[model samples]
Target: MNTDVDQDDCWICYRCHKKLELKQVSVLYLGGRFEVELMQCPQCKMVIINEDLALGKMLEVEKGLEDK
Candidate 1:
């Protein structure tokens, strides 16, 4: 889990405008797929990727794929 994200805090869904729930989801990036826990809307199934995960693990994975 990314330390930057506050798991206790509740997030609102942008699409459905409902409360978001923390869930493990699979995301595709730069032809690679990985699973990460993120905020998601149960209604619309929209996933939210915070800055920490984007700049941290996801970026690292993307770079690794690109290098290969």
Candidate 2:
């Protein structure tokens, strides 16, 4: 799977606010629980929260469209 980071969508973590130099995690969200097996951030080594990250990207895209 292609995990290339989209710079515009990727942002510095709120807690650390440092750009995480890592590949995007592919996730499969079920009804009650996530099915992510072993996704991890290369920089901080933390488990990637795929849904929240994707939501953030959507918000960014919406904002960009509104700005136009």
Candidate 3:
């Protein structure tokens, strides 16, 4: 849930071409609110959800909520 954006990462925003920074983002899912640090664009406010998060913890939490 927490990660640092290293200078070597060099992740550029597709839309703004600005560098991605590590920021705290609020995620609301299944009536639950969670705060996670992720790579985000400062100009456009776009958040990048990586593959590990999308198919890993996030997916697991989503499935668990749907089954309840």
Best by lDDT: 3
lDDT assessment of candidate 2? 0.49
Runs in model 2 deviating more than 4 A are: 1-5, 8-10, 22-24, 31-68
How does candidate 1 score on lDDT?
0.79
Residue pairs that clash (backbone atoms under 3 angstroms), model 1: none
TM-score list, all predictions: 0.81, 0.29, 0.81
Clashing pairs in model 3? none
What TM-score, to 2 decimals, does candidate 2 have? 0.29
The total number of steric clashes, by the backbone 3 Å criterion, in model 3 comes to: 0
Model 2 residue 66 lDDT score: 73
| Candidate numbers, best lDDT first, in rank order | 3, 1, 2
Candidate 2 C-alpha lDDT tens digits along 1-68? 33334545655555555565544444444322333333444556565445654576445555766787
Sort by TM-score, top down from the best: 1, 3, 2
Minimal lDDT window, size 10, model 1:
1-10
TM-score of 3: 0.81
RMSD for each of the candidates:
1.8, 9.9, 2.1
Candidate 3, 27-67: lDDT as tens digits:
88668888988898999989888777777878888999989
